[model samples]
Target: PSNNETEQHSSQVDQIEEEPVRYELPLRTNRDVPPKRYTPEKEARRSRYPMANIAKGNLSPEAQIFTTSLYFEEISTSVEQALESKV
Candidate 1:
């Protein structure tokens, strides 16, 4: 090889020696554990009073009218739509 080629190769090797070496990160191994099962009585309480389930013994007549009106409006709207499509 020529003297210029040897000098250029030595210059590249000197630049590489001056630069810091790269490193890889270590792998993580930590994980979380889940909670255990729920009891039967706890399940019953959540089921019985699910936000919309009004107590028959506690609701007044006026409140009942409001609830029934909502149901009737929904039923009437569905029925009207069904009838209109038949033609």
Candidate 2:
């Protein structure tokens, strides 16, 4: 009898309700954060990887053309500049 009363009370206590969730939009704090600008020198290095890979075997007819482009020249120039600046 005591066990049944305890179980009934426990079940009633567990039936308490919960509040629904409310959604809010995010507030931006840094409105003045400037957008990124791309330069030709920066873009040259970015284009080197694919060209380098394609020129790996030196098999493609365009491989020579690809490696000899102005893009690779910029990459080489940047690397040399970096090394020179260190000394």
Candidate 2 wrong stretches, greater than 4 Å? 1-22, 38-49, 55-87
Query: What is candidate 1's lDDT per residue for 1-87, written digit by digit as tens?
Result: 999999999999999889687687776444354445654556433565464776756779998778778766533358778797677
Query: Best candidate per TM-score, number?
Result: 1
Report the lDDT tens digits of candidate 2 across residue range 1-87. Answer: 699999998887776553456788687776787766755565444564564465456457576666667465533358778787677
Top candidate, metric lDDT: 1
- lDDT for residue 2 in candidate 1, whole number 0-100: 100
Per-model lDDT: 0.71, 0.64
Clashing pairs in 2: none
Residue 73 of model 1 has an lDDT of: 59
RMSD of each: 12.2, 14.2
Residue 45 lDDT in candidate 2: 41
Worst 10 residues of 1 by lDDT: 27-36
Clash totals, every prediction: 0, 0
